[model samples]
Target: MKRSEFIGEFDLDAVLTELSVDLDIRVTRRMLAGACIGSNPEDAYLSARELRESLEWIHEGENEGKVKLTTILSTACDDFQRCLYYCVAGKGVVTMLDDLVWLEKLLEARGRIAGHIYRNKLPVKPLVNPYVAAEPDGPLGRFDPSFAIGASWSHDPGPDYDSDDRGPGPKLKG
Candidate 1:
């Protein structure tokens, strides 16, 4: 299960500790909180605790099926990289980021998680619609490559989408 969903009700620090234990990674909350672009992190508090709680709620509200090993690796890594954004979100700071550092860290975390999945032989399954960015769409059909929303991603589509936009979504732009 994803950190967001597995323990969404926990705080970011709690969740981070869980992930560190669960995924065998070494990440400092200070670093994670500092990663927040706008979070002052009051004494570097970096509400990792709050993040875990919220994500737990989010995940509990939408947990179902077995999260595929490959899928989890793919998405969890994405989250690890995107962890900074989530931290900001947890801190009630709304901002945008398209950086590669998160991706790299995410990939690294994925590699580590992959080892666990291999040892456990878990099946790849859908957790939920991951956060994706759409491009910018001008007044016309220029399209925003950073669009991150979707339609009916509540469940995977059955071979009807013209493209892999996750769910059956129309032409959308950020």
Candidate 2:
């Protein structure tokens, strides 16, 4: 998305389709944004979409849990957003790289259908894993995951994220 564009302007299905190389899915802008409790609508929607895409491989038949992937992803997005608020509100500091690393572990555990269906539940709280050994894949400076922030995910003085000029990083409360 262009810096000039507001997040509400783009269709979420189109964004997901493009992000996934034209994979057909029925997602609306509101459904995308509805999952987050964050103040920044743009970031919330972006994070939800990314989480959805990451976990979309689980088939309905494989999912024995009452909660859907959408619901699980929504909770995950809320956790992510709460961390963003924490850092932006100056409650604590979590590096963008560390945040990504944390998320990657969540995805790793959740990628297994059995694990996702059995380990995660409704009203899921932020989870911390001790096995995140993967090195962070993106730039380590700011909250710039290409999935969430797009190309302009840097520590530049442009994006107006929750009245904090700094990039939207998350500090997960332990």
Candidate 1 residue-wise lDDT, 2-111, digit = tens? 54354323122333334433322212323342343222223113233333333333334423211221222234222433354333232211111111233234334444
Residue 158 Cα positional deviation in candidate 1, in Å, after optimal superposition: 46
Point out where model 2 deviates above 4 Å.
Answer: 1-80, 84-94, 111-174
Tens-digit lDDT track of model 2 for 58-135: 212234221333343234222553332223222111222233334334334333432343354322233332123333
Candidate 1 Cα outliers beyond 4 Å, as residue runs: 1-99, 123-126, 131-174
Q: How many backbone clashes does candidate 2 have?
A: 0
* Candidate lDDT values, in order: 0.31, 0.31
